[model samples]
Target chain A: MKDWEKNIRIVEPYVPGEQPNFPEMIKLNTNENPYPPSPRVQKAKEELSIDILRLYPDPTSNLLVEELANYYGRKKEQVFVGVGSDDVLSVAFLTFLNSKKPILFPDITYSFYSVWADLYRIPYERPAVDENFQINKEDYYKENGGIIFANPNAPTSISVDLEFIEDILEHNQDVIVIVDEAYIDFGGISANSLIDRYENLLVVQTFSKSRSMAGMRIGFAMGNERLIKAMNDVKYSINSYTMNQPSLYLGVEAIKDEDYFRENINKIIFTRENTKNSLEKLGFDVLDSKTNFLFISHSQYKAEDIFAELRENKIFVRHFNLPRISNYLRVTVGTDAEMECFIRSIEEFLLKRA
Target chain B: MKDWEKNIRIVEPYVPGEQPNFPEMIKLNTNENPYPPSPRVQKAKEELSIDILRLYPDPTSNLLVEELANYYGRKKEQVFVGVGSDDVLSVAFLTFLNSKKPILFPDITYSFYSVWADLYRIPYERPAVDENFQINKEDYYKENGGIIFANPNAPTSISVDLEFIEDILEHNQDVIVIVDEAYIDFGGISANSLIDRYENLLVVQTFSKSRSMAGMRIGFAMGNERLIKAMNDVKYSINSYTMNQPSLYLGVEAIKDEDYFRENINKIIFTRENTKNSLEKLGFDVLDSKTNFLFISHSQYKAEDIFAELRENKIFVRHFNLPRISNYLRVTVGTDAEMECFIRSIEEFLLKRA
Candidate 1:
C-alpha cells in the first residue's frame, strides 16, 4: 500500500454499461443503435486487403475529415475527427476549456463531463437541471471558462432549442461553447449550422448511434478553423493515429450511404414514440425524449426493483444510482419487437410487486 | 483575432513520417513491416459479421487482453492495451509521472516523449545519449519523477542491453521506469522478462513494428497490477472505448500466430544486417542497428540531399532536421528487392556527385 502507487492517478472512474455476451439477453443499455451499419460498410470490410494494415493510417484522418466537412457543408479546416465523441470532447476540454474561470454544464447531463473536467483539472460548475429535466438558459450566461453539453441531454433525454443555445453563445462571446450533438441525428436540430455565425461553437456528432458504427469508434467536431487547429495540435500531440484504417475506410462508406442512415433513424424515432405511449399506459412518467433512448420512472414501482427484475428476466436497461435520478431508468429504444418484450417484462415486474 | 484560444493547448506537435499513397513508391520513411499480417488476421477480417457494428466494443478490451496476457505469460491484470503506444505512454504520463520532480528520458529518444510531457504539463528532463548512440544507465539514476526510453531507440537504431535497463530500474525504486520496446523484436532484448522482478518497471510494446498492424493501431503496456489499475483509472477517465472492435478482434488473431510473427521478425533482422553492410560499403557511417531500421550518415554526402534524391527516384527515407540527428537518415529495412533498388539508387546518386 505504501509503494510508488502514492503519486499515481486514482479516481472513481466512470463505469460503462455491461456488455454481456449472452445470446438470449435483451440489451437496452449504452444507447447503441439496434441496426447494422450500411451495406457499403460491409462491402468495405469485404474488399479490405489485409496487406495494407502493415502501414500506418493517415495521422490527420484527412479523407474522413473531407467527407464529414462535405456532409455538413463546412470547409475541411472546420472539421476534426477523433476515436469517438468521448475523445473529441476530452481533447476539446483540454484545448478550449483551460481558462481560470469555472466552466458550466447541466448537473444531470452526460456524467463524463464532470469526470473530464476533473481529469484535466479544469474548474467547472454543474448548475442543476430543473425538476422537469430542462436546462435553464440563464444558468449558462454566467462567467465561465467554457461551456459544453449534450444537445439531447443524456439520462434526461431532453433537447434544448438552437435559439436558446445561440443566446448562450451570444452571451459567452469570449469562451468556447461545445454542443455535443451525439444524438442530434435522432430528430434533434444540430448546432453545426450555427458554426459560421458563432466562431466559438463546436458541434460534435458520432456515427455510433445514427450510423450504427459504435464498434468502429468514429466521431468528429465541426467548428471554426482556429478552434479546430487547436484541437488538432492537442490530438497530434496525444496520438497521431487515433482512427485506424478500417474505421476510417468504413466511416467514409457509412457517410456515403445516406438512405440507409435515414431509414434506421426513422425506425428508432418511430419506436421511441410508441415506447413512450406504452410506458405512459403502464403508469410511468416518461420524459420528452428526442434521443434514441427514453427516460422513465413509475410512481409505484421503484426503478431499482425493476432493473433487478428485468435482469432476472434477461432484459437489461440502464438505471443510474446517482442522486436525483436513482428512480429513473434510461432505456435505449431497441427494435420494435425488443421494446414489446421490454414493456411486457416491466408489466410482469409491476404485477409481481403489486 | 484575439479570442479564448490564447489559454488553449499550443504545443509544437510531433510530426510523424509521411504516408504518401503512391503505388510505385518504396516507402521506407516510417518503420512499417515489409510483410503483411498473419493469415489468421485476414481470416478474422473476412469472417467478421457487420451486424456487430451496432454495439460498442468491450470498453476493457477483455478478449484482446486475455490473448496478450497468454502470449506474454502475464496475468490479465498486468496488461494495459490502447489505440497505440502513444496513447499508452500518454496515459502512463498522466497516471504514474505525477510527482513534483521532473521525469527523465534520453534527449533523442522517441520524439513523442517530450510532446506528451508538454501536453500534460508533466515536468521532464532529457539527458544526452553518449557518443556511440547509447543510453548510459547512470544518467537515469538521478532524482526524477519517472523514466522512459525506447529500446533500440527510434531514428538512432541503437539498443542497450537488459542488464543496463535493470540497473536503472533497480536504482530508481521510488519512480516508474517505462522501457518502450517498440522495436525490441528486431534483435534487441525486451525488458518484459524483468517485469516479475521490478514492480516499478513498465514495458510498452506495439503491433506496428513486429506484427505488421500499424494501420490497426494496437499497443500495450505490461506492469504491476497496481500500476495497471492506476493507468486504467486514468484511461477510463479520459475515454473508455479507446480500441475499436475490428482492432480488438484482429489483434487477437495476430497474437495467436507466433510462427508468422517470428518469420517476419527474422526477415526484417536479416534485411537490416544486409542494409547496414550495404550502407557501409558506400562510405556511410552506419550505426549498429538492433531495430528494423538503419541509422546512417555519410561524410561525403548530406542526408537532406540523399532524402531528396531518393524521393525523386520514388524511394522515401526519413531525414530529421532536429539538432543531433540532422545529418542522419533513418532508413526502414524493406524487402530484399526494395533494399537492392535503394542501394542502386544511392550508388547512382553518389556516382552523379563524383
Candidate 2:
C-alpha cells in the first residue's frame, strides 16, 4: 500500500437490494411502490420548459417545502427536504447526535442506522427487539446521546401505535428522537401529530414507497423550527442544492392530487392483505404487517433456499442473513397479478422439495 | 435554550449568489450557461417514460459514469458522479483529508473550501495568494494532510498553467491533491491530462456551467482507480442514490452533442473579451479572466455601489464582502444582447458619477 493511502477513511458500505432490469421479472424487493406516481406528475413534467435547465434550482427548495407544509398542516419552517429518506436521516444523525455517549436503536431495525453511526464515528449501541420483532419502548429509557428507529420497521413490517411512540418520547425528552416513517403512508400512523407537542422529535418520510416517485429522489422531515433550522445549517454547509429542479416541481404535483394518492395506497394495502392470506395457507407464518410488505418464515424450509428459488424463477424478495432472522423473507407487496405469480412459484418449489 | 439543543452541530452556512426571479432581470450573478442544453437533451426528456418514477434510481449511477468515462478517454472505474460538484468535493474532503496535519489551499480561492474544512473539523492552512491573486506553488511543498484549489479559481477568474500544476504534484506526492476545474471549460487547461501520470491527483468538474444543466444538478470527478474507489465507498455510505434518473439519462445526451457544447463555449469567450475591452475603456481595471466571469474593480466607485446600482436596474452581479477583495465585482458573461444592456447600464452609472 502507498503511504498516502494510510489516511483514507474507509468503511464497509451498506449494500442496497439488487436492481435487476429483466424485461419480464417480478421485482418485489426494495419496498418500492407498485403503482406509478400521480397523473399530475405527468402534467408537471410536460409543463417544465427545457430552457430552465440553465439556472440553479432554489437552494432552499421553497416551493416543495411550502406544498409539503400545507399538505401536512405544519408551518413552513417545520419542513426540511433532501435527496431521499436516507439522505434526510443521515443529515439528522450528523446534526443532532453529537454527544460523547452512545446512541441507541433497535438491533433488528433499518440496517442503515448503524452504517450512518459508524460513518460519522458516532458511538452507538443496539438494544435488541423482543422475540416478536417488536421495539420495546422501555429499552430506550436509559441515558444516551440520541435515539432513532423505524416504525413499521424494514424487514419486519411491524408497527407500534401512537401511544407506544409517545411513551418512549415521554421518557427520552432530554435527547432527540427520530421516528423514520418510510412505510407510514401504507398503513402506519405518523408521529407528525406530536410534532407540535415534542420539540425534540423529528419525523421523516419519503416519496419512494407511497408517493411512487423514488426515481426523482425526494424525502423530508417535520419538526419544530429550531431542530429544522439546525439540520438546514449543516445541510447548507455540505451541499446547498440537494434537490434537483424536476424533483421540486414534480413533487408538488404528486402531493396536489390527493385522490390519486389515496387510491394507490388503498390498492397496495388490499394486495398486501390478500398475499398474507395466501402465504399463510401455504404453511408460512407471516408477520402481521402494517406496511406494504410481508415478512414470512416456513417451518420446514430455509429462507435462503426460498430466496434462491424465487430468484431462479425471475421473482425478487429480500432476505437478511443476520442471526435470529435468517429464516425470514421480506416480500414487497406488488400488483395482484405479480403476487399471484410469486405464490405459484413458491408452491412449485415446496412441492418439488416434498 | 433546551438541554438537548447543546448537542446540535451548528455552523454559519455558505451563502450562494442571489437567484432573484424578476421578469426582466439580467441575471449575471451566478455563472450559469447563457444557452439552453443540447437539443438532444430535449429529445431525451420527451422520450422518458413517467412510469419509471415508481422505482429507485440506480444507486451507482452507472449509465452517467460510463458516458463520462467514454467522453474523457478514461476507464469507468476512474470516474465518479454526484448531485453536483459541491457534493463531490465535500465527499472527497471527508475521504482523503483524514490526517492530523493541516491541508493547504489559497486564502482568496473558492470560499466553500474553508466552510467544508470547518464542517468536517479538518485542520487547514490557507497560504495567501499573492497581490496578483496567483497561487504560489512553493507554499504547497511543505507537509500537509491534503491539498485542494480551484484552477481558473472562483471570484478571481485566473488560471495557472499545466506545468505549474505538475510541479505542485511532484512536491505533494505524499498526500492527495485535488484540482477543482469548475471553470476549466471556459478557457483553462484541465489537469485531467496529468491523471495517468499522478495517482494521487483528483480532478473535479461540473456540467452546470458549460453544458447548461445546473437545474438538473450533474457533476463528476476523474482520478486513479484507487482514489475513485475510496470516494465511492464514502459516497455509498452517505447516500447511495445521489443522482436522480432524469439526470443520469439526460446527461448522456448532453455529452454526445459536442458541436453545441463547443459553440456555446466559444460564444461566451467571445462575449467576455469584448466586455473586458468595453469596461477598460470606462477606466475600470479588469483582471485577465480565463473563466465565464470577469473580476473587475473601479477606482472611482466602490464594488458595493456598483452592485447596488445594478440591482436597482435589475442587472444582478456578485460582490463579496471580504478582506482584500471587497472592492471587486464578479460579473458572469451573458448573451450578446444581455451584455450590451449591462454595458449601457454601467455607462449611464459612470456618467452620473462624473
Candidate maximizing TM-score: 2
Candidate 1, residues B5-30, lDDT tens digits: the string is 65677889677667887878999999
Model 1 Cα lDDT, one tens digit per residue, A1-354: 655676787777877778777788999988999989999999999998899899899998888999988988999999999998999999999888878899999989898999998888889899998989888899988888889988999988889898989999999888899999999988789988899998888899998899999999998999999999889989999999989999989999999999998898999999999999999999999999899999999998889999999998888899999999999999999999999999999889778777
Clashing pairs in 1: none
Instruction: Please list the C-alpha lDDT of all candidates, in the order they appear.
Output: 0.91, 0.93
Model 1 residue B193 CA deviation (Å) reads: 1.4
lDDT string, candidate 2, A42-82, tens digits = 98888888899889999999999999999999999999999
True contacts kept of each: 0.89, 0.81
Model 2 agreement with the true structure over B1-354: per-residue lDDT tens digits: 788898898787677667899999999999998899999999999888889998899988889899999999999999999989999999999999999999999999988899899989999999999999989999999999999999989989999999999999999998999999999999999999999999999999999998999999889999999999999888889888888889988999999999999999999999999999999999889999999999999999999998899989999999999999999999999999999999999999998988
Question: How much native contact recovery, as a fraction, does model 2 achieve?
Answer: 0.81
Candidate 1 C-alpha error for residue B228, in Å: 0.6
Q: Using alpha carbons, what is the TM-score of model 1?
A: 0.99
Docking class of 2: high
What's the lDDT for residue B227 in model 1?
84
